[model samples]
Target: MIRKLAIIGVGLIGGSMARALREEGVVQEIVGCGRSKPNLERAVELGVIDHYTHDIGEAVRGADLIVLAVPLGAMEATFRAMQDHLADDAVITDVGSVKGSVVEDAVKVFGEAPAFLVPGHPIAGTERSGVEASFPELFRNRRVILTPLDNTDPQALQKVEQAWRHCGADLSYMAVAHHDEVLAATSHLPHMLAYSLVDSLARMKENDEIFRYAAGGFRDFTRIASSNPVMWRDICLANREALGGMLKRFADELHGMADALEKDDAEGLLEIFERAKAARDRYIDGVE
Candidate 1:
């Protein structure tokens, strides 16, 4: 059990983690730190945290577990702010989508990725933001991937794993670079497509009419476009190399589809649609 849990950003993901751990009676106290006092107050009102502070040092002073849930762009600054104040035995972890960039930030701040620090990403979240949207069940049965360095402290890694398990998450481990690459393809690319498609249509001359006549498929496919833009922007920039490769590959596939359409290649189009349907069906079946 964690004696004291310090959450560096008390937004949706951070607040949800606190709620889950509190529900499991695994954390004695949760102290939230964020730039927004109103949000922190709301977190306190929602019982998501025991207390709140704007100072990173005050938040981590005696906490044994620290969760860096801030955006990827803010990671290095957050790390630099709290490093001097962190307890010697503190187990550090983050929920950043880009593991390699997070590891790089830690190295930049601490001269090396500390043994007690574990980089993690939970493969779950709605197109929602803020502490008010948080719930204890957000991570229930969801996959939480941890990318701990080879020299990471075993006890620290175990503690972080235990915390996520208490949140009802299914934990998995991978190398930092591999995690980034996989997430770029599966998660980041989809978000990019959703945002790009929505923006493209919204800027059209007949955007109002287009949206008014849109079907369920369009709404479902673009739901992620409603997600926090700043967070997604940071993620894309942090994992640019992998995400760029994915975007290029997708563009090539899209060009091929366009060519098929222009040539009236019904067989080619049907083949692509069938393959996609089969793959999606397999995924849905596996998850269900």
Candidate 2:
């Protein structure tokens, strides 16, 4: 029943959401807002949005739902700009990977985390970005986590949940701190490792040969390294504390593996390998 849906950042995630909503006939009109005029124009041309504007206020006015799909770094400024322009009963949500910082910024800009302001993260995306890379089925069968504060309104939370459900997302709820910590390990740290591994290998003396000989495993493991740099940069910085803790644990495990290798402990290496394989198998089994 969204009369007008306004997306603040009309990139891949936002464009995908708009497309999903349009397919479901949940939104009557979609308005796109971004800093780049050309990008917005392209979004309109692709029919990802009904109209485009650089003015945040103009885009959000009369909109019942506003989705902030911008990078983590630009959230505070975007929230501040649109705070006063939002309709009285408008529901504000975001697709940001980090939740704690997003909640804090929302409180800072809106005086508190109102029930209508739900901090969310859709556990879905590909390495590609931009409006052209968007697809309506991107969220199908994917998990969407919503971290709603204590002061958040039940009705507002339900509305946001239903919207995601309409987009074919499975919904989960968690505390903001818990969400940040879990995402740090599952999403943020993995991306960091991918980027680091790729960068380190690319700087080797025989870099060309290394890449040329890389197999599917290497390509699959580092696929996320091709993600948007600025986006990951902001996420890593914003969740630095949690990500740092995860990195330390990861380093310790790596050291354990190194110790086993140095001692030629085949048993130890096999145990670690088997345990990892078991864990991954369990996850795949559950998901499938």
Which 10-residue span in candidate 1 carries the lowest summed lDDT?
Answer: 279-288
Worst 10 residues of 2 by lDDT: 106-115
Model 2, 21-102: lDDT tens digits are 9999988999999988888898989889999888999999999899999999999999889878888888889999999889
Number of the top-ranking candidate, with lDDT as the measure: 1
Question: Candidate 1, residues 141-238: lDDT per residue as tens digits?
Answer: 99999999998999999999999999999999999999999999888999999999999999999999999999999888888899999999999999
| Candidate 1: pairs in clash | none
In model 2, what lDDT does residue 92 have?
89
lDDT of 2: 0.92
lDDT of each: 0.95, 0.92
